[model samples]
Target: MAQIDWETLAGRVENAPSLLRLWDALEDYAQACRDVGCTEAECGLDLRRLPTYGGEWTGEYLFPIRDDGITIRSHDETHMLLDRERAEPRYVVVPRSAYNL
Candidate 1:
């Protein structure tokens, strides 16, 4: 597979019509990175450039791990995206580990 431009993916997520689509695309990307054996550094997303809102959305929503060693807290943008009260979805570039894929 060709190297996916992070900027392009970020743009797509930003323009996505809904949160569902954003998550779908992000999940797919995470899978692709895993398939290609991407390193953690290579698979990380720049969270600062993504959108965020107010709320508490845990990382467990995306990656559920029972181990006590693992702590899942939603990234700022993810927190906003997970907000049930928000009509519009937010976007964020989370690391591969964040997805736990």
Candidate 2:
């Protein structure tokens, strides 16, 4: 399958009428996660299929994870634009380390 266009996907989120408010909320959540050594964070709105319909919104924040001089590469799945069922108005911030997993 073709990879989802994250830049374009982000654009969708950036275009929301309440972008600033939403962004601030996400940033606060992400900062809290980062303070606790979190690696990634994301928020997703009502999603059920590809080419999201109305009332759909999504956002993501990724932080570099370093371990032993190695930086783990990761993508934010919450901002993905694929056909899938995602509950509306969901906010999740993964505040943990993968290196210990």
Q: Which residue pairs collide, candidate 1?
A: none
CA lDDT, every model vs. true structure: 0.45, 0.32
Model 2: per-residue lDDT, tens digit, 7-96? 444444444344333344434443444455643233332221112223322342122233322221111323222111132223322312
* Global Cα lDDT for candidate 2: 0.32
Instruction: For model 2, state the Cα shift of residue 32 in Å.
Output: 0.4
Residue pairs that clash (backbone atoms under 3 angstroms), model 2: none
Q: Candidate 1, residue 61: CA error in Å?
A: 13
For candidate 1, write residues 1-101 as lDDT tens digits.
Answer: 57767666656655555455656565565555567787323766543243433345544343323433232223444332332212222223344345443
Residue-level error in angstroms, candidate 1, position 85: 25
- Against the true structure, whose lDDT is highest? 1
Candidate 2 regions off by >4 Å?
A: 1-17, 42-101
Please give the lDDT score for candidate 1: 0.45
